[model samples]
Target chain A: MKILVPVKQAALVEDDFELRDDGRDVDPDFVDLQLNEWDDYSLETALQLKESHDGIEVVAVTVGDDDAEDALRTCLAKGADRAIRVWDDELGDADPVVIARVLAAVAQRETPDLVLAGTQSSDLGFSATGVAMATFMGWPHAAVVVALDYSPGAATATVERELEGGLRQRLEIDCPAVLTIQLGINTPRYASLRGIKQARSLPVEELTPEDLGLEAQDVGEQACGARVRKMYLPEKGQAEMIEGTPAQQAERIAAIVKEVMGG
Target chain B: MGADRALESGKAVMGGETVEPQTLIGRLLARPDAYAAAGLLAAHPDFADHRLLRMALPDRATGLVFAGMRFSPACLLEELGGWQDSAVQRRLAGNPATPAPVIARLLDNSSADPDVGPRLAAHVRTPTDALPGLVADGRLATRVAAAGHPGAGHGLLLELAGRGEMPVLRVLSARADLSTALLARIWERGDRHVQAELLRAATCPRQLLAAAAHAPHALWRRRAAGHPALPEPVRWRLLRDSDARVRAAVAEAPTTPVELLHRFQADPAQRVRIALARRQDLPPSWLDSLARQPGAWLQRWVARNPCCPRQMLERLAQSAAAEVRRAVSRNPATSAFMLARLAADADPWVRAGAAGRADLYPSVLARLADDTEVDVLGAVAANPSTPAERLAGLAMHDDRDVRRAVAQNPAASAAVLAPLATDPYPLNRFVVSQRDALSLATLEALAGDPEPRIRFIAWKRLGALAASH
Candidate 1:
């Protein structure tokens, strides 16, 4: 059995950050790149399944530039059987749907028993790629999968989908399904000393879009579902300070609440 | 990969590896060995500049190695100044071999790396010219290191004192080079922590110790009470400090007049009496008198003191308070026979304490293995001298804790630990997986275990073994 996980390196904006010269995003100098928080949980889920069963392989794939290889190496350090990185200079600023198309092409060749991904990326919480990839592949997929029970090569797997207001829906999904894992599903383990040493020597196979049967037009901004018009820090909301003794402060709070209610 | 490609692309843009210092320095510093990188850069001075080296030294370790090299050219160390990374800059600031001018350059960039300021201030070779920037640094550690610097003159110390942060003042108070004029100025504004440092210095004027002994703050009085230089009259004044802790400090001071020590024996505060009882250097007569007290509090401390008279330990072994008896059981002064008696103590905790001792006879440890209470049995399971047969028996005891303790025992033979590999508790199985001498069959079995955490660890160990072979 093989489980494929897609990961990304999310950029974190530091305090006192400045906008890029183009005013489209944070400046690169003010950003630190790390593995997406949700992807760590998703990869741990795949590793847990691999450890509990025999002859199970986990492959981590990402559609990103060279910097994104760090996320794939982190997955391998946590016991992924293989890592594949697909990148091309033309894929710059490609929206989530284009990324989904690139990942679906890799999935078509590998044909994993299951695919797992974070419900959303930390940088852009689109919550679209996993379901979109499933749509492109014409395979069944579930989102916010908080619990999963599956056997290698099983005809179907049981999963519990978290819903609005703390509700959960249990369903049986068919084999070769895609599941976007949610946080708190399991506690992820840190990379052990030996695993880190081994990951350095383990090969991370690099591929271009053409190697995955993708064309330049299929995985570029032209294929995007949405384009960002402009990005800026939103104007901070204002707050008023009320200073007085307890009774006077209470009176001001009551007046504001009454005014807000249009009394 | 992108960084390497960028380096290559820079070369491609140059048409060839031309003599342009930018391309030449980049190519030469790319050498894996720091010495080779430094040697190449030193041999070609035209390619060395602070800006160019800053751009080339992101690897950081190469810069750190050359920054500290004694024989590296001063010009190279100077040009290696103020890399973007604080660690590289810190290494340069801390290196005695770094030229004073480079140290000054690092101090100028202290805002970019606050860590460099403190190290530069603390470096022995730092010129006085850089002390002003260091003293004004926003980071308190930098200011404190500057205040403590040997070359810091009285004027610089006065300026640091003007800032008046307690930690910087504390460092200034402890400086041997500080003059009496400056010391008096610091004593007036310093807090208890600084005053305590002043009292600790043997050269501290007798008048300052005398004033501290009568300070309004109880904590200051407590510290002053212990100062060896305190005037005899002031020691008597401290004995009357309303705070028991202050009186207790006086009670424990070696220089405390014997008459005061005798009065402290009858001091109203039990805390004072306990302090007097626990002193290792208390004359034998004083220890005997404290041991003769009715309460267990003073005797328990006396029993635990290695210098406690042997006669006092024998009496403490029969103490009604289990804690007092337990204290005696673990005391190194307790004789073998006394330990054996404590092993049979009626209180299980006392017996548990006796069981954990490293010096207890094996025969007594074996007898403790039969203790009904799990606490005693658990301690017996962990004792190094417990007979293997008894440990094996305890390993199968009904309590999981006993079995866990047995699993943790280094003395447990592989035969004793083998059965624990499949113990019902996952923690026991986890402990079993961590042992060094597991048989291959057991390790292979654990590698396929149901628990994911244990399996991960066992597989790592197996991989390490395979690599070793």
Candidate 2:
């Protein structure tokens, strides 16, 4: 059985400075660095299943420019058997539902028995991507999996979906299916020294929607399910830190209390 | 020798053998000798901000020394009353005698300082007449309570067995050291807002019992019965109290003398009589009296606790309270003559408690299960001796709590649990979910249960079942 894993990356370090959109009208540098926290869990789940099931092969896939290839390469280095890069330079501001269409088109070529993705990409965090992908593929989906089990005839997993009001409950569903894993599932194994060396030699299959019998017209901002009308920081006020001797500070605190109490 | 200069020097000397800055502050903070520190403060204007200097002068006598030092009153107020660790206030309140001048200074200047909330609260015990309302509010209560001196720590504490004065006891009780004093205090004014503090202080059983025992009045004796660890005094009173709660408190008393229980059985309170009927070692005559009981209430209570003296129930079958008579009728342990007596009872709960036993009569529990009163039905539902088939049948009767009781019974079968599986209350579902008797299929049925709490328990149970494999 083959399993397909999609990996997304973001910068490891937070950039303290404001983002500057380069001439392409995109912040290429942000995409040019690091991995998303959620996608890392999805990547690990696939790798672990392949390690335990001798015949299974895990493939890492992504859809972005050359910078994203660095992230896919990182996945391969971690133990994925192969890498697939779907180069799409114009898809930066695309939403999840559209991205899901693109991803499903690419994934059709692999004919994987099961597909794994993160519950949500931290950078975009639509959280609708995996569900959209499952709908597009017409496969049963179980999300936020905390545990998994895979045997030939029956593959099942237990997941805890976060619900309204900070509540969580477990759910189970059969797989040969799509499963989006929440963060901190199984610990992701790091690339071994030998694995890293072997990863450098692995094949990367390059594809586009055209290669998968799809059109670019099926994606981009037009095909997106939602719209972001504005982006700006919310107004904030500075926090005051009162300083004085303990007694003086205490007195101030007491005075505040007195005024509040109207004493 | 220059006598004039010598006299000036005597008064101006900053430190002496017994009055070194450190010892003087430490001792003065600890005793009435605090006058020593006061004296020092009087001498030195700079020492008010001198926390170290005041601390170093350890004795209370040094309050005077502090006063003598002309310490800046502003700074002394700052060091003494600043929100700080208990060690700071503990040192001050521990002073057997506080310097009157310093206290005077506090009263005069307490409101003058900005941090007067905690400071004024801290000194509430300083014998000032102008306290109550200022001390009662939240800010002061929390700060003063937190700044509580060690001896005062016993205010609300349940375990303090010491015989201190009422004020000290009040202080201890406030801190959650629930004891006789607290109970008595609660008893006296427990009906009023005074109970708010006691309620806050003693939520636990031992403390509740101790507090109840010491509760000042009979009303608290009944109130104490509503809570845990029956207070000894409340227990003693409940052995004769008119209220069911009081009697229930007596029934829970681990050391209740059988003789006291005997006298309690004859008390005017029917609830007391009902309570006495539930005990295991009730005298034979008590069972005899129950046999003739006319009321269904007596029989229901009797049947719920089946081990009581059988002879009294035999005699109680003839009581006017239909419930009591029903109790005599439903008793399985009742003799043939006893059954004959209870069979004539007007109330069904009484008959149900004394009804047909295999030894003399058929299980009358079935008849009582159909009684009109919800209370009797509840009695049958709670009675362990009721036949499993009969109990299962009652699981569907309208009351959800009775159904809950039936569902929770160890003897309840799968057939009985299936209907309750659809119970609206999560409590009933939780009971059905937890019973080992419920198969994995039942748990699966509850997996999609609407109540998250129930669903959570079901999931946990499923996980445990999965792990055993």
Candidate whose lDDT is highest: 1
Candidate 1, residues B96-177: lDDT per residue as tens digits? 7888777767767877766678888888788776788776767888888888889887888887787778878988988877
Show pairs that collide, candidate 1: none
Off by over 4 Å in 1: A5-45, A89-203, A207-263, B1-79, B82-91, B94-119, B128-145, B162-171, B174-177, B189-204, B244-278, B283-304, B309-469
Q: Write the per-residue lDDT of candidate 2 for residues A13-40, one digit (tens) a residue.
A: 2331123443322233222266677877
Candidate 2 chain B, poorest ten consecutive residues by summed lDDT: B1-10
Q: Write the per-residue lDDT of candidate 2 for residues B83-177, one digit (tens) a residue.
A: 24232333333232334444544545444333443444455344434343334344434234332433333342332223323343355445544
Fnat of candidate 2, please?
A: 0.00
What are the candidates' individual DockQ scores?
0.05, 0.01
